[model samples]
Target chain A: MKSIKEINQKIREGNICVVTASEMKDLVSELGVEKAAKEVDVVTTGTFGAMCSSGVFMNFGHSDPPIRMQRVWLNDVEAYTGIAAVDAYLGVTQLSEKSEEYGGAHVIEELVRGKEVTLRAISKGTDCYPRKEIVTEISLEDINQAEMVNPRNAYQRYKAATNSSNQILRTYMGTLLPNFGNVSFAGCGEISPLNNDPDYRTIGVGTRIFLCGAKGYVIGEGSQHCPPYGTLMVKGNLKEMKPEFMRAAVFPGYGVTMYVGIGIPIPVLDAEMAKATAIRDEEIWTEIIDFGVARRERPVIKRVNYAELKSGKVEINGEEVRVSPLSSIYMAEKIMKELKRQIEAGEFFLSAPVERISKDCVLKPMRLKEVKLVRSVMTPAITVEPETSVEEASKIMIQKGINHIPVVKEGRLVGIITSWDVAKAVAMKKVGRVAEVMTRKVITTMPDEPVEIAARKMEKHDISALPVVDAKRRVVGMVTSEDLSKLLAR
Target chain B: MMLQLKFDPKTVKKPIISLATLEASALLNIIRASVGPREGELVVEVEEGKAEKVVEVLKSYGVEVHSIKKAVERDEEKCVHCGACISICPVEAIGFDDEKRVVVNTTKCIHCGSCVNVCPMKALALP
Candidate 1:
């Protein structure tokens, strides 16, 4: 076993041996976990992908009149100004009203690149700060402090996204092709920081990390952070971050998100740490979630490992579908290499966590939900007397925008006629009572029936409409393909 | 211009696309297609100059035809070589070059717009 102090001493003397997570897999196999742990002083890991729960807190210097800013907009992208008078949080996903493609993430990237950004704010008048409005350009140097406080930066594991339905789905996981033609996964399997330290043994509060190529610290567990698939909330100096490690993205139908590059170094304290860092892509499994559902609970098409994901294709629905990584493996590799070099040069040192992150937590989704029923969806049946003329029945169907009209006798359904029957009657010039064109054997349903069963009955009967009747056979309402489709689409 | 052709059970087995490609004397780039022996839809693209001939062949088959546009544009200045769009492109229209920079192939582009949505730089656009 080794202490973090010993590892720091070795790093200072240029005597430490550092290997990236990708390289450590082979190192562990060749030397075994015990020897590899004794030989290697540190293992560096990284991940680069679109992290939506990211933003920057900026302290814009007070204007000449000293305004207590209540509303703020940077480059037309609104920032939350409820924090303080001169401080606001620019969330990465906040889109610009002027141009949706431009967003808060772009502003953060610009600031990191040393580019100037336009700042505008409005405030309610107050005696301590009477200024009402202020507008100016501010760069990284002009701001008092620009700190990046991302609520969720690194994910230990994540599900890949795919579409099995006929229509293309534009989602946060990127655009999924129809019929499961493509799959996109975001987690960097072997070289990922959280994957290397699946358990929070070395990564926790106050643990230094590489955030967007800046020296940063893990502040706490992320918002959706949970056991078995932990995530981290990190903080860093925005001005010290590099543009290459940060980027702005817009997922078309989905809103804006920032691509964050995060790297963590693990000290080789014991053989367990070495074995954990050596975990290969083959052992890492993630679900291929069907994004086509467009719901809180998406269907899982299948489970696949990163090895199959990186090989370019995976078997989905008994067919080979191409797989892609929305997470930039290229950038992740570069970040890992940079972190390793920093440790080797003694420019970066590993630190013990001030406090370990909580492990007893589970992500809970919003509980508000609704289940549709046939009674609520069905419309009141439009009826016509059996002795009514065919032309009159057709006119009622046209005026009400309905295809089927139930012919009634004494306020009870006796038969049904559709637009097709009316057209046939007109084409044949068989002008007579509605009863002549109507079919007597009506397929009936009950109001309390589940929508699913009602829909299945229609499909099974190969019919478009069903009349809802009470116990005494009085027509109450009607359910049609149009109504069910409208409800399903929602 | 792009043309969508419906292939019914009778026409699905016929070589309609190949015939159109040969007689039109132009490359009819199939943008999107899902034709089965049962029945399906096929969307094809051709040079505007040769669209008339392609439309003529499609009409001769007595199939439904409609024009559509699904073109994706790339802005080189905004791209940072982050490679976010490389894997999401359904047609592999976007790929890495020798130096690991992303390159787009216009001919192979299916106009699916998958890459445009995944691009972190907003470098790719479906206009």
Candidate 2:
């Protein structure tokens, strides 16, 4: 039995394998079908057909698609610390609802989670669409153990197999890229192995490439007709593949994939690898098209010639014209110059109306400032002296459109009478004077008191307005609901 | 299940261990323990007339007041000579003149340190 390390080493030395199908010209060109198929030991001629026929076959479902994974090593402590620093910079903290402020729960959670735990960061790709990158770190021991299980077993096997290959890619990329960010473990998919030689028994194992990052616009090209997992590669120049210049590469998949490296042992390797994959995925086998600069179109100008005028009629360039019913001939001449200017400035077109304003005229708009409150603005109250006859008081209420009255004696607020009091007196047929029906107990408020307090007191007592009084208990200014409303409106 | 066993006692560590083994949970527990409980307090200072209104508003919002102290005031005329106000006023609201007359600043006096009682000249009064 060969050790896992020996199997991986042998697989790395084997010949590259490729596959091609006659119907899939696009896929074949992308994978280098002829050359890859000839070098591999196991060449399945009908593999593509088998994949097409088995619409829902379990493992076969993903067999035909190219697979990639992002592998990260977590040996360095600085990588862990860097993740913590980023999280702090992002202001990820717990907020309290009661105090409406940041609290300790967030800090506690961070300390417990070892900071290097998988975190999702939103980033903009070459396509300008937001992509989520999973930043995390995993132990080598965990990777090795992952190989022994059924599903979990595959991760470890791939980790061990691709370690050396990734190291070579990482080193080569280091000298090639600038400001290479960190690399972390990302997702993996199945791809046709480069070499299927018997010596390459671990082809499936070592074939899994670590995804560093991606470049160009990745669009979902195949998603409309079928479930998309395949990518369409657009060919472009190497210079075009740079992070700044690259356009979006359409991936027929549902959404874009962003792989983030966290707690990675080789931070430079991770970032560089991601960049290379992005460029490769962007180019590979794309159709060529001319994308040239587009020119701005100039505005077209139309000429209108006005001729001699006669009363309401005007002649233009030997043609006599009656003034338009909607506009005067004199106005039309003024509008013509404006219309011409508007067209030259590209401000108005044939579909828009051209309007002319007098040069000397200026618009003065009005705005409201404050609302003033006064006694006349209120629902008025009847006024009378205590000596007045009941007949006179009732007549005063009818004439003044008031329901309540304050009875003054010797220039003092003595009592108040309302329409209800008069109605009660009339109903009882008490043929008497004003003092008999008047309620002597009256509520009054000072002018300096806040209007709100006066309003509250009136509401509590079920009255309309408070008769404002001076230190001598004489009526001065009257405050009512209308006054309060005016103050509030202001 | 097969109960058959082989006698190869190489003591090989299990390759696949649960994630619980890496102190992830232990570390989380430690963090939770370290957080303890929050101790939050807020202090607000208000003028005499507005203090009652502020207290009423705070009480409506369910805040409790631990204590209330009257702010200081000074008698402009009575404070004179001796420099007793300057020595006894804790907030330094009082100062002695070059002519040996004592001066009292009504604003800085907190009312808590009553220098008026200690004045030998009986020149200081607080309201």
Best by DockQ: 1
Q: For each candidate in turn, give its C-alpha RMSD to the true structure in angstroms.
A: 9.0, 37.3
DockQ of each candidate's interface versus the true one?
0.32, 0.01
Candidate 1 ranges with C-alpha deviation above 4 Å: A369-377, A380-394, A398-490, B1-118, B124-127
Per-residue lDDT of candidate 2, residues A1-490 (tens digit): 2233332333354421211211123433454544322232221111000000000000101111221111111211111112211222111111223332222222212222333323223233223322323344432121211110011111100100011111111210011011111111101111111111112222222122111111111111111111111211111111111111111111111111111110000000122211221221112221111111011111211122111111223222343322211011121122223322322343321111022111122324454463232333443334689888878888888987666778889889898878888899899997478889899988877645555557766886788777777678877766776677776787
Q: What value does the lDDT take at residue A405 in candidate 1?
A: 88
Which lDDT values do the candidates have, in the order given?
0.85, 0.30
lDDT per residue for candidate 1 within A239-278, as digits (tens), equals: 8999888988887767888999999999879999999999
Candidate 2 lDDT for residue A367: 48
- Candidate 1 CAPRI category: acceptable
Q: Comparing to the true complex, what docking class would candidate 2 get? A: incorrect
Task: Note the residue pairs that clash in candidate 1.
Answer: none
Interface RMSD (Å) of model 2? 46.0
